[model samples]
Structures are given as structure tokens and as C-alpha cells.
Target: MVFWLVAVGCLFVGEASSSDNKITAKSIRVVMDNNYPPYAFLDAKGNLQGILIDQWRLWEQKTGIKAAISGIDWGEA
Candidate 1:
């Protein structure tokens, strides 16, 4: 009975330690101007595509996170 209890305790401790080593995904939100040219701008069809957007895409790909841009007037930003 003592051996069984020790074995169960060791198993629980190992599981707990493994769980502690697990990684968690980070949640992030970035707000940017989708109208600023060169840095960030909308395409002819009003799609967000620019230098900054490209950089953001690279960042998202590296970090395995989703990125998005919303259009807001200059004054609101």
C-alpha cells in the first residue's frame, strides 16, 4: 500500500512538472492607421496592403499569431 501511494505521488508530481513546462500562446492586438501612405495604406480596392502590412505579416508568421488592421479616420486615430 505504501509503495502504491508513493508511485501515485511520483506520477502526479511528474505530470505537474510537465504541465508547468508547457508553453501558452500570447494574445495581442495592434491598432494602426490603414490610411497613412508608405507606412500603411489601403489598396485601390480598399484592402489593407502596404509596407507596414507586409512587416506585420512577417511578424505574425514568426509568432504564430493573427494580425489585423482596421480603417479609422485620421482624427479618430
Candidate 2:
């Protein structure tokens, strides 16, 4: 499900480290289809809102690593 996908994505993110095996990046960018309801989509105010969005926000709070989540068209994904 979406949870597993997000988990796997987080794993890959950690793999993008430097030669000393350290993650030098201060933030991470995540792009997904904006049309997927309940998982990812825009709200009435044109703001990103969904279960996945909330999850990422929580991840940011827990890890202190900013997650720049963006929603794009399915075709663009």
C-alpha cells in the first residue's frame, strides 16, 4: 500500500549519502501524482492535502529533516 511505498522511498533517500556514509542534504524532495485521492491531492485552497502528505509532515517533525513534497500529474510521475 501507500505506507510501504513511502517507507521504501525513505530508505532510498538515506542511500543518497556522501563518501563517508553521511547524509549531507538538509531536505528531501518527494513528487507524486496529485490526482490520487486519499493518498495525495490538492484541497479547495489549492494546497497539498492527503494521507501521504500528513505522513510526510509527521516524518519531518520526527526526523527534523524537511520533506519538500510536491504533487504533479500522473503522467509526469
Q: Which number leads on lDDT? A: 2
Worst ten in a row by lDDT for model 1: 22-31
lDDT of 2: 0.89
Task: Write down the TM-score for model 1.
Answer: 0.58
Residue 28 Cα positional deviation in candidate 1, in Å, after optimal superposition: 2.6
lDDT of 1 by residue, 1-77 (tens): 99999999999999988987744656466677778888888888988777888898899889887776565667787
How well is each residue in 1-77 modelled by candidate 2, as lDDT tens digits?
A: 99999999988877765335756678999999998999998999999899999999999998888999989999998
TM-score of each: 0.58, 0.69
